[model samples]
Target: MSTTGHHAAHKVVVIGGGYAGTLAANRLRTRPDIGVTLVNPRPEFVDRIRLHQFAAGTGQATADYGTLLGDGVRLVVDSAERIDTAARTVRLASGRALGYDYVVYAVGSTCAIPASVPGAAEFAVPIAELEPARRLRARLRELPPDAPITVVGGGLTGVETAAELAGQGRGVTLVCGHTLAPSLSAPGRRSLATWLSRHGVVVLEAAAVNEVRPDAVVFADGVVRASALTIWAAGFGVPRLAAASGLRTDALGRLLTDETLTSVDDDHVVAAGDAAAPSGRPLRMSCYAAGPLGARAADTVLSRIAGTAPAVIDLAFTGSCVSLGRRAGLRQFARKDDTATNVYFDGRMGAMYKELTCKVALWKIRREARRPGSMIWIKGGPRPGQPVADGARDDHGARDARC
Candidate 1:
């Protein structure tokens, strides 16, 4: 065990090695005054947004996290079982305890499947993790060319999966509980609809699923028989780590965080990615939010350690990018707050844009992992206000008053 002393440096613990957690650890590693430790089950980072492409038999989507994390950041290859906030310790499944001065909770999220839905768990496959998506891809290759496939959920994942399957010359149908891409603006939605139609994808909006049979998906109004494969790409909820830690969280298990991404119930604990809820509003679960939010969490931690007041996390979603396949996609422009605007792009240009976005996201992770503690250069434009300096804030604010 490392000796504890009255040192000038503060220890920062980051859970999960996905986009948000990895970036947070990398950013914190840049500061010599901060001791950073990253805990995750996997040594490599998987680009989850491209899981659809992997499922459609494209290529492997894994990157080495060892080379990605900056120096001075300790990589703990284990799952975090629980976080003891009061004790400032994290319990790992490997039977080790990590003590930290600050904790960044970026445990990420999971694909939620309703237990009430019969046969759903037994038969349907979800692209929640990389292995499952890869398995689905292998399953697809084994099926007959004209086999019927049903994709549940009309959200971005479902749409992308259906489009990819259709492009692969399989008969595909999308079953959605509400309108397809419900979060998208009219122009983006229309563009997606046209693209799906062009690729021979049968979209059934407002269709509530009742049960899943061996070869069919039964809906409330009708039963879609002849389904050779079923893909569930529904909504996602955060892992239960926050609630299990006795921290304040939303109904979906997202940690309730203040404007600066610090946990409301414990200032020493901050959350980002799919596991973080920003005050009254719930940030959308996307890599776009996670990447920036991760950096903000690290900044908040670093500022607190340096006694500097952390800048408020200004989370503004500029737009949405959805890939239909390798060749087609939809780029929907939105306001700073993510309100969909009239601007839309389609066809190969949109696909290229989506690919570039993924590249940029990975690039940010790579850059931060190498340099650490540096401000992520926003490609579009500058954000208002001066960057918060490290160690300018009071230490008393790190404790939760209510506790």
Candidate 2:
């Protein structure tokens, strides 16, 4: 809609202003002829990577869109209700219809608390999203200093939350459904275990919660433990927008796309971030993947406009980092394919690395906003012609439960 002497030949509407959507919108600014509009439910950008810190009252987790998005991108503070791909229109929850030549589907994942677990939906507080983290913070404020806190799930979120609360002097217990920090190497897990033990955190590996009560959790093995507060960090689920919109999606509702990040059903609709399952093989859901995928999604759209063949997605992962608390952390390195490596960093060095990673994530988005096409990622992934193997998705679901 900018009339600054350049009329837009095409318009792009990016849904979900998370790391992916924001980057896609910013990257689209490289084409002045393409008007870009970003749709998000909230006005500010939520730094989801730090939601645990927000819940634990250790740090903040939001930034102004003014600082994160490019000037060429318009911000629409409304949720996308549906996408009519055939019509190339996005219907907003506010009842407005946004016509776009192309659309970027990046409506990230959410906390998944199964109702199958008795009372979990009612008693357990999930800290995956901003609102949930806010609720957890308020609830923590209401509890006494010696309140017994129970963190369920052995993933990164669970481990981090338990460590954070324990650092605050609360009696904490981490109930890992299986191995603790399952995504990390054995030594990394042992290091975390030692730290948790030294801080009086009772880590229950292989303990799955069968039920959550008002004051305790019942394990699958028939053990009942008192819990003043139960924090759920089990895993994440994507929005049902794609499936409801009639687009082809994977079992979990993530939009199915080709290696170029374009939806198989409609080339005009592309996907990125956690909501994207490319070639039926989704990379681990993490901010590390989100930004690069966002860049690729935008490039794909740009390529179509230019009548050029967009290159296949070439992305790699270096590792994953988890903050133990304000001053401690564990950084586990990974292969290009995203599997755990034996190399790990712990203690203050790890904490510093974790903080740097978070800062760098935001910095990358901002840098792209200032200079489109300036971003680059680790390459050397599977060749485009290769068939995706069975269970090809590199899953570190527990480590990136928030993604």
Q: Identify the leading candidate in terms of TM-score.
A: 2
Give RMSD to native, each candidate: 7.7, 2.4
Model 1 misses residue 273 by how many Å? 1.1
Candidate 2, 1-403: lDDT as tens digits: 1223124799999999999999998899898888898889998999988988999899999999889987778888999999997788999989999999999999999888998999999999998899989999999999999989999878788888898899899899988877887777788889999999999999888777999999999999899999989999887789999999999999888999999999999999999999998888776787888999999999999999999999889876676788888889988887766667799989999899889889998899999999998888889865364432222122226236232
Residue pairs that clash (backbone atoms under 3 angstroms), model 2: none
Q: Write the per-residue lDDT of candidate 1 for residues 1-403, one digit (tens) a residue.
A: 1222225268888998888888888787656677778888887788887777788887566788766777677777899989998899999988999898999999987777778889988888887678788789899889999989999888777877888788888789998787787656787888899988888899988888888887989898776566889998876657888888899898878899877888999999988777887773555677776778899899898888878999877755566778877888888777664566789889999889888888877788878866675545333222234222111011100000000
Clashing pairs in 1: 306-391, 307-391, 307-392, 307-393, 308-391, 308-392, 308-393, 309-393
How many Å off is the CA of 362 in candidate 2? 0.7
- Which residue segments of model 2 deviate by more than 4 Å? 1-7, 383-403
User: Candidate 2 — what's its lDDT?
Assistant: 0.85
Q: In terms of TM-score, how similar is model 1 to the real structure? A: 0.90
- lDDT for each of the candidates? 0.76, 0.85
After TM-score superposition, what is the CA distance of residue 277 in candidate 2 from its true location, in Å? 0.2
Error of 2 at 35 (Å): 0.4
Candidate 1 Cα lDDT to native: 0.76
TM-score to native of every candidate shown:
0.90, 0.95
